[model samples]
Target: MSKIAFIFPGQGAQYVGMGKEIAMEHKSAQDIFEKANESLGFDIKKMCFEGPEEELVKTEYTQPAILTTSIAILSVIQQNGIEADITAGLSLGEYSALVYAGALKFEDAVKLVNKRGKYMQEAVPLGKGNMAAIIGLDRKEVDSIIKEAQDVGTVEGANYNCPGQIVISGEINAVEKACELAKEKGAKKAVLLPVSAPFHCSLLKPAGERLSEKMESLNIGSLQRKVISNVTGDYIANEKDIKDLLIKQVSKSVLWQDSIELMLDGGYDTFIEIGPGKTLTAFTKKTARKLKKKVKCYNVENTKTLNKLLTELG
Candidate 1:
């Protein structure tokens, strides 16, 4: 049996000219950008195709932009009759997974993530919050190290990205201290990440509260496909749990590695990174390696990638 999982990339994966070629080739993909523009009341298509980099990188813009481009690329994949048996995504990328699952409509997702991004940025001041990547270290050790440095501020593991890669986020001093401590603790590398806010940590609880209010107004539908939640890294239980999980995801660690592991354990043998960047592809491959599971990985950000996927999967 060949089960496929479609995973999406999160922030730091966005770049100018992401979905243009896909949009130009597929009318369905083009319609997605047009609809996003109508729902958002701005030309997100232009921003994805022609970005100044400065404006596109803003937290508020980046969330919606990536979600839109993902759905656009998803539209093309659907038209080509390729589908996933399961799906998951990283932090901001979770919204894309929900959309693909039919748990959230594309239009509503774009709007929601737009406000979600703004709330996240406003939750912590620029210099006050920080995030860093601790490579070649285990989460338990990272957690212990972060707990040791809590007095410095409010740092915690934000993203359990892969086997040996964990992202910690919180107050600036705490995060910086944790990084130094990680270096001392024999971590292969401990480096700070360039991000606007300390997302997915307790510091962003206020942001989650804000997102809850916005989520209430939207009409979320039942899942049409299995979707893994970032907070739990497992199958989303039911429709009622969607909004709460999404809200909690704002201030919770993303169990991305766990999510991929669950999929592989459940028999998903193929993975396609459907949005921008091959970051998730790398994560999935690394995770599969650690799990001693065999899997095929692919990413579709442009026509060439799409053609390769279609030729094989179609």
Candidate 2:
């Protein structure tokens, strides 16, 4: 049986004015933004709808901003009767996925990510850490490059995004060295990402520890639907494992390619990305093509894209 997987994008996917149209058109979407404001005790909707870009991009603000926008869009998706057989997210996006799966409450998730963002940012001092995307290099090649770079400083593969794209993160000098090595190894491109912190690397382990402490106090519910974990790239069979998985995810490599492959192998042929940008959707396409898998991928961040996807799905 063909199934649908709802994928959510992580931190870097946020932007000003994301989900504005949908929030304006759909009451459910608007209610999410309102709820975020009430829960957060600030007007995140204003920042998202009219960002100064600087404020919206800060790791502290960016986490909840992206989460709220993604959930708002998710509300719209659910309102339209679109649902997922399984769900997964990249990095911070995992919280959104859990919330959608009924394993985490939206209010708790919003607050948790706020703290998570703050902790992650504090893990590494500004300008001391960096991340770079290596294109046209397989995971093994990128791993090798990161290992070689570790000779200079701490560098590790942070995200295995797809067949030919991997993100490495760690010390600034080490990341730069890795990028140079990746280019020398004939990678198509090795570009530094405009991110605030070196996320998903050992350098951020302190942040993970802190997040684990925070998670211990929260109440996680039973899953309404299976949600793939980024750390394991497998289905989380028990709700008891959610907290530990989320904590480990903070400082572990995001096995996005593996997660997508797992879904594909499980007969999920359609993917709908419910979030701010189309980054996850794009990655889905690349992963599907590389694996020679036929799948339909769509992103719903606005009314037009939502309508188009609804039509296609119908």
Cα RMSD (angstroms) for every candidate in the order listed: 0.8, 1.0
> Per-residue CA lDDT of candidate 2, range 1-314, in tens?
55899999998888899979999999999999999999999999999999989999989899999999999988877877888869999999999999999988999999999999999999999999999999998888888888889999999889999889899999999999999999999999999998888999999999999999998789999999999999999999999999999999999999999999999888789999988889888888898898788998888889899899878774
Name the lDDT value of residue 313 in candidate 2: 73
Q: lDDT: which candidate is best? A: 1
How many angstroms is residue 69 displaced in model 2 relative to the true structure, after the best TM-score fit? 1.0
TM-score of each: 0.99, 0.98
Off by over 4 Å in 1: none
Across 1-314, the per-residue lDDT of candidate 1 in tens digits comes to 57889999898899999999999988999999999999999888899999979989998999999999999999999988889868898988989999998888899999999899999999987799989999998888999999999987899899999999999999999999999999999999999988999999999999999999888788889898999999998899898999999999999999999999999999899999988999999998999999899999989999999999989998
Q: Provide the lowest-lDDT 10-residue window in model 2.
A: 76-85
User: What does the lDDT read for residue 86 in candidate 2?
Assistant: 92
lDDT of 1: 0.92
